[model samples]
Target: MRRLLGRRDFRTIFIALTVSMLAESVLVLALGVWVKDLTGSDGLAGATFLALSAPMLVAPLAGWVVDRIPRRAIFVALNVVTAGLLLPLLTVRHAADLWIVYTVAVGYGLSYIVLGATVSALVPELVPADLLPDANSALQTVKQALRLLGPLIGAGLFSLLGGAKLALACAVCFLVAGVMGTLLRSGRQAVRMPTTSDRPTWSSEVSAGLRHLVREPALRTVAVCSALSMIGLGVGESLYFAYVDQGLGRDAAFLGILVSAQGVGGVAGGVASALVVRRLGEVGAVAVGIGLFALGSLALVQPALWLALPASVLIGMGLPVSMVGTNTLLQRRTPAHLLGRAATALDALVSGPQALAIGLGAVLVGVVDYRLLFGAIGVAMAFVGGTLWFARRVAQPAVSTEPAPAQADFPG
Candidate 1:
């Protein structure tokens, strides 16, 4: 971990991402709470996630753009633009202005896809292959750790001040992060121009990431399993608001506390991720995370605060552990030129289901018992995790080979 920090470029990127993520974490909870307060509808509040994730359906375009531009430039531009984009939230004065909130959510989603693809592509250029796990772990750890304070600070500011003030604070964080982007000295790549013969058709360019994932055994396995787990996760996204209000008998702000608990668990998971990856391999680590998340989900069925807090912790822990494993595997396996598209393709695969599920959960939370949803989520995740674990063991040899297309770039 110290080794990654010791590098000037990694340090700059790390700090930039940290500042940016702090802004996101602050907004994540506050946005839902703000919408809920305005409309008094759990469905609308949950739909904010739908708004945010809806842009992921266009991830291929975002990926193409990321790959075309210099990643560092894209990184800087995205933060600056996102800061400006968020300013419209200042205009959302009443329920009639909910459009402003949803619009901003869509903008946030677009920026998230572009910026995430840019960062995923840039990281491998900045670090050694062997340190990918540690680097990813460090990044994940800090992002999760900030949830502990970011949500609290967001909640406090929202309750004491207002959502507009909270929005302004987040904009400042993004601006500061953009400034930090200028400090990065590595992971800058020249614009990629395809040779005439190799010029990609629109469909080919857009689908490149998905094609790569399909061709790689391990990547495909992990991605499919991860997407399956998101089914429950998406359901939980909406259900949690109801859980806080009806089940736990708390107000909207209390949702921040549950998120903060998850952050605590995320911190521990991030710290331990590299160790888990080393012991279990990336696939095995992902399986472990899914199983842990399943346990956490099942625990939520009882609806007690005592159970909820620990369940949030387990959910938090599982996220980083699984994410670190997934990301490291992607970075290690993919070629540099394709990283942008591949990352976004993976995002589309996972987030698409999650976004859909959020909508379903929003509706389901009203008619169905939240406990039933939680139990179903837990069981589904447990089954996916077990399937992934079994597949990893049986398909060990096949997983070792790189995709056929990747070989040209990585010729021995």
Candidate 2:
């Protein structure tokens, strides 16, 4: 991990990523607060999140843009575009201007897709193959760290400066991140778009990532189950606040306690991810992480704050571990050229379902009991774990028949 961080390119990208993610965390919380204040409706506030996530459905198409453009350009463009889009928030003094928030949320969502694909494609170019796991682990740790502080910082700033000023602050963060991204050392050429007259149409281009994802057996299984996990995440996203307020008879402030506990777990899991992947292999580690997450979800059915706190820790740990394992697996399995598309495809698969699930959860939470929803989410996660485990067992014979890579074996 130390060696991975010592490399100049990786270090630069990591610093830029950390700044951008922290800004995103602040922006997300402030946007929610902004929407809630304007409309005084939980449903509308939640709808803001939906707008932010809904553009993930377009990720495959965005992947084409990522691959077609130079990665550094995309990275810089994302921050600049976001900064520009967010400037309109200063004009939003009345409820009539709420559309600007949703519009910007969609832009934010699209920016996530573009940035996610660009970064995934750039990592291999910036670091050695052997260091991929450690690099991903370090990045995950940064994200977890932000989870602990970003919301609190954003909420505090919103209280002090009001939403318009808070939006300006986040926009400044993006501008700084864009400048930092410009300092990254240029590497390989991004995948070029075919200009042949017979080139594939737009729809075919959009589906390219999905096709690649489905063709790789290991990636296919991980992508499918990860999509399931995202669905569970969507359910939790809508219900968790209500669970804290209504189910536990606590104020909304208690949600931060759960988030903090989860951040603690995420940090621990991210620090341990490389070791876990080395011991379990990517597939086995993912299965274990999924099971752990399921166990945590099941525990959420408990009404006690103490129980919920620990359960959130389990959830936080499980998600990042599984994510790192899956990401490493994708990187190892995919060719260098297709990395951008594959990453975006995975994003499209996972985030699209998650977005839909978030919408469904919003509606369902109004009708269903929070405990029952938690139970259902737990069951879905367990099902995903079982499915992956079963697939692994069945594919054992075929695994040996598959040709091994020319490089040294992974430390499984």
Candidate 3:
């Protein structure tokens, strides 16, 4: 752990990523509050998520551009531009105008989409291939931990100074991230940049990514499981509030506890995954991780908050494990030239289908009881896990490639 923390490159990006996450968290919590204030409806606040969901639909296109371009330049520009883009809110009141919010959402979500791809693709270049899982676990530990904190901070900030303040804070985080990207340098292109012309067709560029995905069985399996997980996430988002409020009758404080528990669990999970990666290699680690987390979703079943402790921890452990695995796989298999593109596609799968899943989940919330929804999604994820687990056995994929130093001897 100490060795991992000492990495300059990872540390810099980690700070930048954490700051950015903090900003986004504030923006989201603030947005929900603003939307609620505007519409006087909790449902409308939920719809604010729809704004976040929109850009995800085009996540593939974003990924294609990410793949072809100099990822560093693109990411830096995006973050810097986002900082400035958010400046308009410093004075605006009457934020209820749906149009203004919608516009902001589009830009915000789009920037996030590309920035995420850049970060994911950049990781392998920053650290050794063998260190990928350790690096990933460390990174995720930062992201998940900060996310849990971001929402609460957002709410507190909103209480003190409202939307403009929240936006300003977010802008600052983006600005800082941009600065980090601009100042930092990579050693050498571990992978070469793919050749492209000034007049390339968008459809063709996207097709390259799609084809790459289609060709790689490992990538396909990973994508399938990831997509399903996103769907499950969408459903959770749509119904979790109600489940907490209406089903379990938990208070805001209790809800916070559950959320915090999830993060804490995730952090522990990340730590454990580092050890697991040391043993299982990257692919096997992820296979185990996803299954564990997929199985972890069982937390939704236990109604009592006390039951949530172990449930959330088990579920959290699965997340970083799966995420680190998938990301490491992509980093190892993908050429530097297409790393951004492939990563972008992965980003799209993470965010795009998730948006749809959230929408479907939202719709389902209106139609079914919360328990039924939880049970149904849980079963669905379990099925997805079974399919993936079996695929791993059949594919008989080669021994895990270590993303970290000690990872080479997997299944040890």
Highest-TM-score candidate: 2
Which candidate do you rate higher for TM-score, 1 or 2? 2
lDDT of each: 0.85, 0.81, 0.71
User: Candidate 3 residues 130-191, lDDT tens each?
Assistant: 66778778877777776767777888888888787778878988999989876556523433
lDDT of 1 by residue, 351-409 (tens): 78877888899999999999999999999999999988887663344222122121112
Worst 10 residues of 1 by lDDT: 400-409
Q: What is the C-alpha RMSD of each candidate to the true structure, in Å?
A: 5.2, 4.5, 4.6
* TM-scores for every predicted model: 0.84, 0.86, 0.84
Clash count per candidate: 0, 0, 8
Measured on C-alpha atoms, candidate 3 has an lDDT of 0.71
> Candidate 2 — what's its lDDT?
0.81
